[model samples]
Target chain A: MSNATKSVPDAEGRFGEFGRRFVPETLMEALDQLHEEYLRSKADPDFQSQLDHLLKTYVGRPSPLYFAERLTEHAGGAKIYFKREDLNHTGAHKINNTIGQALLTLRMGKKRVIAETGAGQHGVASATACARFGLDCVVYMGEEDIRRQKLNVFLMRNMGAEVRSVTSGSRTLRDAINEAMRDWMASVDTTHYILGSAVGPHPFPMIVRDFQSVIGSEARQQCLDETGQLPNEVIACVGGGSNAAGMFYPFVEDYDVSLTGVEAGGRGTQPGDHASPLTYGSKGVLHGSFSYVMQDEDGQTQDVHSISAGLDYPGVGPEHSYWKESGRVQYTVATDDEALEMFQLVAKLEGILPAVESSHAVAHAVKAAQKRSPDEIVVVCLSGRGDKDISEVARLTGIEM
Target chain B: MDSRISAVFASLKEQNQMAFMPFITAGDPDLAATQQVIRTLGASNVDMIEIGFPYSDPIADGPVIQASYTRALESKVSVSQIFKALGELDHEELPPLVAMVSFAIVFRTGVDQFLSSCVESGISGLIIPDLPGDEAAEVFEKVKGAGLDLIQLVAPTSPRERVRKILKSCSGFVYCIAVAGTTGERERVADSLLDQLKWLREETDLPLAVGFGISKPDHVEPLRGLADGVIIGSAIVRRFQELADKTLSSEDLQKELTKLAGDMVTATHTK
Candidate 1:
């Protein structure tokens, strides 16, 4: 990777016509302000030193790049490596972006931080940051998500964050985002929205992606240090594509390295049954930016289903859309049963409980690994731990938790 | 540059009266009830009417409008359905109709085709809150070429430079977001509204119309001299929300909505 990646986004925040500020006029100034501040923060020595300190001490950076020997032997064709982001504080890569945004909130002199969460990982991470900084935190989670991710909800509450239940639409991640956007519009003066994903309007996708790029940067160095070469392929689950974007950006220009993003396949290939927008959606807008979205011919968003709440969104990040369009990254899907199988297998075989979201990547990696030569290597980003999902997993497998 | 919208605002300017445009989701109750709502507001001395195309994710709208869109979409209302439902009613019976739709919908359907559809449906102006920056300059031309006006939203938070850019692209009028928030009812219009009105007035000849949180007759009075028009959304849509009770007939809905609109419409005549 080069020292700079040409800032993927142009002045209008568009990654080739994919991402732009498609929010209300009221939020335009804030978006512009955020973009400017983010750029400045990226270059400031003090900002970088402070953020780096937090990453190492608070969030516990340089998560292990472990060789999954049993899984590699099971595949029987290629060696597999897991970038253990699951070990991060709060048990997910969500903390990486939230901590960055929370710091920005203080820089902007905002006293409050608001966020929308799907499976509660982002909510917990945002709550943790606010607690650490003594800032007010409010998290919006879908009513249905709260029921599924009760433990994460508790964790967020424990950190002094107000959890607001969103009951509109499908009562999931998508609805929570809508509620959060409305909240930001009403409270833009004193509140900063710590959007959970690398999606949404303008600067958000770029900002989140920048914060998350640490994943790939660390992974790239670890693979080089351990194996003396870059991994053959880098893979990550695509919820709003933050982890994937973070893990993929550093390797985009490394032509020899392959990048794959795994999306949720839910129950079936049908639009409503699956959240695989890149696989079977038209170019439209959801949340804020223009991206691939599961929608009807009349342009209304379709309800999407996913076993992993994190990937249940109707749209992918604009950067993913651009990458797919440019043929830089190949995107695939993993069904509920496939992810669950990998989730259970990883727990027993490697003593690691990969989040169902991350298992999507593992599912694809296992398949691809079996087809490659044993000398070749594949690195999968285990984005988060599965503790928050244990109860839902039990219910799905016909066990009483 | 546009025909119907410009004419409506010009005639109001001559009379020194502010235009009253009441917004309602096109299929709030159903197409039949929506027709009655449009006809009722049209006959109640409104200068123009704004019809919202119900979207599944209306992020810029408040709960009242969001629920209204949900009701409309759940009833299986389609864009063509709304256009076909209102196809028989010509502009003369409806006044000039303006469309408030997401740019995502337009981009998905192809910008030229969406504009042509609006032209066919007799929609004279458009209010899209989420139109992208680059697409705006391009679509603004297509909208004018299709013989319709583009009404861009300008918030109080919009800086002077952004306001200038928005003013350059806009045609029919300015949709002033009275406060820095999504569309909803408010206890009072923000005091800073007068200054924004003055700032925009000094920038362009386009009419300045305030929306978002302006619900009652009192809401209109505050903007009497400063605003060229007043847009009532959530306050009006909340009444349509009552249609969910199923006991109210379309005529009764029209009567109730008309009485409410009549008072607010009268309030627009600030003289």
Candidate 2:
């Protein structure tokens, strides 16, 4: 990436028409303080060296970009490869961003870290980071999510983080975000909000994408080393579009590579159907920034449905909205039924049980593979392991054990 | 006017009709429609307009209001938009625009900036659902400095000490969150809570507005003799949604709101 393109989001932290500081007024001074602190710490060689050391040593780095040869043959089309983010410590790419932000939080002299979680992956990652850095961590989860993802609740608690169940709204991800924001507002003087996804108002998306860019950065080199060329297409499923944004960022300027984002197709495109914002939603603002959203005629947000708790959301990352508008990346959808099929297919063939959210990408890859040349290579971001989603998938699909 | 908010409340009280406080999420449905709803409510008999600054999680709200908030967030309503919408009401004879929002939004917007913006936008009062009285001192000072009223809430579960604290900081009117939980309509207001309201009436001279569980005309009428204002949230929001079909025009919505306001006013004034 050229300096011009790489610095697209400048010191002010803008990503084209996407990133900007759209935080609450109470958080302005603190956010400004954090921004200034982050800039200084990012520029400090010592800070970079320490962060790199942690990313390499504490949370395993250079996660393999393994070509699923057997699975590719079984699919009977383009060769498929997996950018194994599940191999990362804490079992997902969430750790990558959390470790970076947590280190930045400590460097900024913050005493505590607060995070909002949906499936609790980010909460666990943030808790893990806080444990390593010796910072007090608080995680806000929706009451409903806490009940559904009990294992994650236990995992976060075991990591020595205070887990507060938010009983607001549907007691889901959005509610958790609200509670986290409220907590941050009250404790901004000493707390850092380790946002889970590439959403929020401004600096968050830019900061998280930068931290998660390592996924694509590593994949590019690894893919080149093994295949002697970049994969023809890359696919990732988007919740807040974090993992997809991470894997797609380094390749944004790589014109030869095609990037596709698969959104949750929950039931169908009916009013109460899925969380496929890109395919079905229109441009609107959410979480302090303008993005695509599913709303009613009165402009009220509608309830979104998705088989995967992780992807069941009403909005996408602001950057994804920009990418969709600019035509830089294509956005598609995969129904819960289709994703389940891919989930089982991958488990049986590759012997890897992929997260239901990741299965959306796999489903998209399967569809694309059927149409593409047999020799073409496609890199699918295997975002996380399916262990956390086993019960949910089993319940939803009526498949036991 | 010593306090613009107090002046407005005093005017409503003099009319012998309990204040008709209509709560609408700014940008619900859409920003344009929200502006229209405000104008519609303003032109109607509404004594005060509580414009909800939509938050992602409204723990204090029921399904109808929660759904409205979801729409507002999806529509990308922001604190800035609330100020802008209020500014647009400059030419019209607007009912005082009092912000009904979560503490997070207030904090995110910045305490002083939010107050200053509210003042500049001609907002008469502030209602932060999550700002318990104990944590409201700093915000109260700011709101006072901006010459706007900080409306404090007294929930059913609030202890006497908390109520005293809330009464001390509150101006304009004391918002009684009729129930222990968040905002929504209920089938009935408990007799014990009514007795509590009677007790509260003896404690403070500030006009009291009973909210949360109020839905029907009977709900408004019963509280009329005891409270200074009857704050209706979820029911009105539900009515707005019911009238929000694409086929219905803004004029139609205004007519619907006018009828709803008329019924509420009738309930409060009759007997």
If scored against the real structure, what TM-score would every candidate get?
Answer: 0.98, 0.67
lDDT of each: 0.88, 0.79
Q: CA lDDT of A200 in candidate 2?
A: 77
Q: State the lDDT of candidate 2 residue by residue for A30-117, as single tens digits.
A: 5557777777877889988888888899888889998888788877888899999988898889999999898888777889999999
Maximum-DockQ candidate: 1
Error of 1 at A56 (Å): 0.5
Residue-level lDDT of model 1, residues A191-245, one tens digit each, is 9999988999989998999899999999999999999999898899997899999
Which regions of candidate 1 are displaced past 4 Å?
Answer: A1-6, B132-135, B246-249
Q: Worst 10-residue stretch by lDDT in candidate 2 chain B?
A: B54-63
lDDT of 2 by residue, B1-271 (tens): 5676677667767777677787887887877887778777777657778888776655456667877776666566767776877787753477777888766566545678778888777788898765656557778888888888898877665556557866777888988867654566789987867887898998899988888888778887567678888888887788656655566566776787788887887776554
